[model samples]
Target: MAASGQRRPYPQLADSPSTASLLQSTETNHRSPEAAFAQGPRYSNTQSFTSSGSTSWNGSPTNQGVLDRRSYQTNSVSEKFSLPADPAVWGSNVSPDFQEPDDWIHNPDPKRDRKSDRGGSIVSYRGLTNLGCLVVLVVGLLALFAGYPIIHYFTTNQLSNLGGFNLGGINASGQVPEMIGNYGLIDADTPSSAHTYKSFADGSEWQLVFSDEFETPGRTFWPGDDPYWEAVDLHYWQTNDLEWYSPQAIVTKDGSLEITMSEKEINNLNYMSGALTTWNKFCFTGGMILVNVSLPGSSSVSGMWPAVWTMGNLGRMGYGASLDGLWPYVYDSCDVGTVANQTYNGGPAAALSGGDPSNGGALSYLEGQRLSRCTCPGESHPGPYHSDGTFVGRSAPEIDLFEAQVSGGVDSAGLSQSAQWAPMNHEYIWDNTTGNFDIADSSVTQLNSYAGGVYQQATSAVTKANPDCFDQNTGCYEVYGYEYQPGYKNQSGYISWVANGDVAWTLDAGGMVADPETEINDRPIPQEPMYIIANLAMSENFVTVDVANLVFPTTMRIDWVRVYQPKNAVNIGCDPKDYPTAAYIQQYADAYNNPNLTTWTGDTSAGGYGQTEPKNSFLGQC
Candidate 1:
């Protein structure tokens, strides 16, 4: 009978072949756990009997099954066990027990090494380097684009402020009244020597010598009829027993004081005309001085002379030894004549036209000579006759006085000199409103003799004869149309004339002569401050004024005087010890030392040779 509660199934090989083999086998492997368990089964009476002997199955022992089963189970349960290859598996052909080659485990093949390498990639380093470079480049470009405009804006703004210092404190707001009082009218009648001229002590440590006295002997008065002659003259005015002669003879009245000249007076004072200096009086080493003068009433006259100029403090005149010496002389004259015939009596008389002589002399004379005509007349005395038949003249003819206010140190060559002309006449104008002069009906004359016109002969002659005179070596003579006349021939080294308000004449002693082509020496350079002196002249040779029947006390009034200084020297103030800078002196000294750098060749071709250098350049050269 079967077990009553539950019957357990007998453990058996399910496969028929295995069961038959097992039944037929005689010995059983006892090494297997399954065989052992099967053998331990209590007392037979279960589903099957346990085998105690070895059994065989189809040429192999069935016990191997138990061993195989137990081994497989053990392998399946092991943590470190690996799956055995099966014939059905795709890559199971590889031997499971075969050891890996050393090359495969540690030193991979060249091709495999290259393919598997994932370290030290150059791409990442290159990328990072490129990124850094790009960042730097971007930053640099940004700075360049944004920084320039900001710098320019600030630089220009600062430069503009610096430029204003040249005008000596901007606009002349409160300076007008003080200037007028300080540089106003001088009583010509009063003897400067007698009336103690008050020299102001402005802390500049400056002293005055001839404050109220005239260097020359003469009395200045005012004109009665015409305000143009606000200042007049007196003849034979003996001051301190010195016989003072009047040039113009008749005296007139104006705001200030002036003295007109007759041919006789001009000739007498010829020695004094060219250059005058105030070295002894003021001792001004460098700076500027301004003088105001009124034009003569009668423009219709030849040899009308008026001038204001300066010379070296050393006090010398003419050319040759005086000019070559350390102390030289310089002068400024207003006159007219051909460059070849620039002498008092050398050139052909200038002509006049347009107005009638009945009113005041020859209209042609007034226009051509007195009006400051620059060009030579063609054919006729007053020229070939313009549509208006008027003579040409230089509407503006005035002298500018420049001096060294302070001394700049000795140059590299150890010579004290002026680097520039403190007072330049560029764009200078006469104020007709407040003075005895009038420019209402006046016309400006082109002082440039080189301009194409009839003045070619004069211009060419002057240039050829003068050469590099008038500091020409330093290009100083280029400032004025006329060259320097270091050895001027004529008595009046520098002279200009106005004839009957129609004709004008400018004559230089050193200028070329017309017929014979004679050369005149140039006046010497000046080194001191000089005052302005403008006057009208009557001449027995060419002009005659009826002073007996004319109004007494005719006057010539000065409007104003203006002094200009170099832009660099402005606001330097008036300090005597360091009056002039080393740089300023060095500039002029260098120019003086180097002949090539300072020399200027005049234009001898055609009518274009009379052009002068600009005032600024002249200053720079000095």
Candidate 2:
């Protein structure tokens, strides 16, 4: 995360020499676990293998068997060839005049030394010189052995860090594995036929940074208006959608928050529904986000475009800001807004006839997404002709973990048995290559279905044909996770899309999208802090009128929304098995599922203009 303007005191870095010396001195009384590291040929210790007084045992040196310099006589060949008494050795004879033996312990055969000695009894010092070199070599090796891994893990910034250990807790290989936990699986033993669930081998220690189990109202929020998300009352929320967005559409009870859409008259508006957002009330730089959900709406309902996504908070202002988050530092024609399909502002938003300003709700909060437009260089899309072009759609750079365009078509296979049309599950992202929102870096992926056992391989276009994975109408209960800005060996980040505890696919910083012609860096990789927005959009008239006008009680049931980071943590209280959508909702069908006598704490003012819920409505999970 870019450092906030706030200054904080940090620990000083250790001086290199001092740190190396300290590492070398930290000798252990117990045998070293790194015996192999120390004994390698390049790191051979200078100490001798055997001492003169002790018989060869493990064939290694011991202080107890070291020769006594005071009693040693070089005249004896055994004494001469053995450890030639060293007065300098600790506990050995300390006589200052004690002449160190020459080739006594090193060369027991006098004939060998006589051949080299040109002057009276002089001996070659080569062995002694080499031993000295090895001593220095060992010191250098120890310094590198102790310090390199730590430095490499932090500074080198390797890509493997994304899947390996770089954050959270260290793994057996000393790298932080990319995955931390698992969620959403129906069959215990599905064939390892495709991709089976990948377990967190060492288990998870990731701390829950944010969680909205939907038991109680959360920190202040809403949309349409904002000192932060004020109660939605989202007038004409977007694209002439029929539904009037109101807080009533949201119900936080029975251990879950159910957002319902129905045909009802509200404030003179024809249809009514709910929407929730964390706008300014909460936003984070990077972390893992999970939303356990089940789409209860019929795909036959046509216009239902339910989504769970995260977008850059800068909105349209990021186009002109500097890295410090200050907007308008650099002026571009696109900043004010662009001509529909006309200018070279960055993307084809103008050409697409999508997005705000051109579509009519310019100043609205949800319409502030200019960052998701198509900005490929040299590609100029003509104006859509209705208004001035900026970004063409709700193009703000985002991580769309789960967005279903419920097509109302079912593939009769596996769990579906017969009656459900599978909705297309999508995962879309922008590579933010220019350090800001650029559409050239954008790519969209759509999965065929949310089949229960589809854990391993992503359900790509080719794989979607399998009836087991794409059966949609039977909206299955499942977990969706988005790991954002994962660490890289280069310190840059990427995003990973996970389904049922296994990775579906991933996108890196320099990733290429569908359009290969554009340079890889043309996309916008969202590095800015982002907040979560989970809403069921009618997509405003995008659905056929028949589906839009269809029925009542249309709903998007969410089990929970949780955010976690790499850290020490404990499990949340809700048990996925017993407290499933079926049991929990079924058990509390008659009465609201309130918490067990505990007081719920949150913004009581935002709710209950005419009513209110108990403090702890349902969940005590944290």
Candidate 3:
């Protein structure tokens, strides 16, 4: 805290709870969770600790960052009780167990916990000795069972010191308090007050597993992997546009990285830029992925199409063989150049003879038409569609975080592409989830602006559509978030993306906006991991005219990119609709306590929703 200009307040031992008060709280709060959503096959229980006398750290407990799950006792001398002070000790937590370890002699372990039915069980208390010690412990137990509201009130509404940087739990209450430092995760320090903390928006403790701060400048990003990035060195690549990508186009200079869009005559060709991706090697399923980038300071290369995007691997099993033919999945991206909003299409599409199918300047039949669902009968491609209004598992493939038409018009209200400009604001829609791949779903909405007063959700699409992110942060830095789900949001898996402390967007079950509508109940959801790509291309295929000045150099300056997931856990599955509220992400936190032990799924867009569910069906028939 001192490093960030903020200092941790000196603890007042006199104001602290008595040792007996803490021990009692531990016993009363020993009730287990509703159910154990085991994260893995078998927990190692490798964590070991010894508590002696009244203090926390005593004997030799491994310093691997694991906390002693057992309760701390005052009477149990020679017993070392590990307290939750550091972030690693917090990660060492596991749910109280009803069953013994994989190996045992016979009787159920006295320390085993069996009360959990749902929610997250972060700690466990077992060993207690003597009547005096037990009596002192009972005092603390009374505080939890009887004085819970009072403790919660102070711990939450009081000063940040009450929680120890708001993440520690060794204070007055002496309970296993929530670690809510950065983004509400079990942070060791207040993230906001510390620049050392990356952008982890989800209110959960996260362990940074990957990062590219560009601190070393030209050094290799992912050494020993498939390489820093798989450069897309090709002229006239897939987008019949101009420009050839080269290693020379990508450079890490100054304090940040730059992917400049400039004109270059190469191999008898004229346009040139750079494109790179961490394919296969550094692909991630779900985590807070954010890049602090300032769009080109000047819109000189208006004709250039630059993007920070990601692609799904539906066809990884075999080209077009995975889900029959679902290849591209725009999990979440931002084209800081030219592109029309998918719903209220605008821009040049409305100008040069319906140049932009979405913009109203010259509305065409396709742009003016609005449909409930896509792919009807012989219609192979998807058509205009709107959000289910209810969200119920609806997700967008392309979560365009920040896409702008540099013609120099739209303001930052829409991240420089507000709705007034049509096809320019933040947009999300289920484009093609299954069948014909012809735009199957449309439930599109602009996530950037606070319409009336609702922001997009980061948990489940079936929840409320409007959430508030304005109060999420207090800096000029932009904030966005999103989620990605697998086949069944409840069963398959889901990944969350938080940027600048807000939900950019979510791709549930491998579904993407502008792609097919894939859900958990039914439909085809992605089953493979997706890779990220950052490129500076020419001409966003959606439009024709240039957005920036045609004769100047424009660069996309990215300060850093940080990716993080739950500490000590991977993608743990759960049915948020039940047990806990559908939107409360705390259940997701339970996944950390139980590593590799997830088992709960309802359905996907395939055999469920439109395929089998009649009342809940959005599309007509299977």
State each model's CA lDDT, in order: 0.26, 0.38, 0.35
Ranking by TM-score: 2, 3, 1
Better model by TM-score: candidate 2 vs candidate 3:
2
Q: Pick the candidate with the highest lDDT.
A: 2
Instruction: Assess every candidate by TM-score.
Output: 0.23, 0.39, 0.38
Kindly list the per-residue Cα lDDT of model 2 for residues 44-133, writing each as its tens digit: 223443324343323444332223221222222242233324534323446755554566666434354556765652244886788889
Candidate 3 or 1, higher lDDT: 3
lDDT of 1: 0.26
Per residue, candidate 1 scores C-alpha lDDT tens digits across 1-622 of 3223322224333452331233332234422322212232112232342441343322345555445445544543351223334643322226755444565567534464654875756679788999899999988887788767777777784432122212222111112122222222232333434333111111132111112223323332222221112222222111111112333343223333344332233323421111122211222222333343333322222222233343332221121111121221122222332121133343222222211234331111111121112233332121122345433211111222211111111210010111111111111111112221112212322232221111111111011111221110221111111111122344423323221221122334333222122112222222122223333323332223344432323233333332322223322111123222223223334322222221112332421222232111111221
Off by over 4 Å in 1: 1-255, 258-279, 283-292, 301-304, 316-443, 448-553, 570-622
Q: Tens digit of lDDT per residue, candidate 3, span 509-589? A: 433222211111123343334455676666555234453335535576666665555554433211111111112213233
Candidate 2 residue spans exceeding 4 A from truth = 1-205, 216-231, 299-301, 316-396, 411-476, 486-492, 512-521, 540-542, 568-622
Worst 10 residues of 2 by lDDT: 415-424
Error of 3 at 63 (Å): 99
Error of 3 at 613 (Å): 31
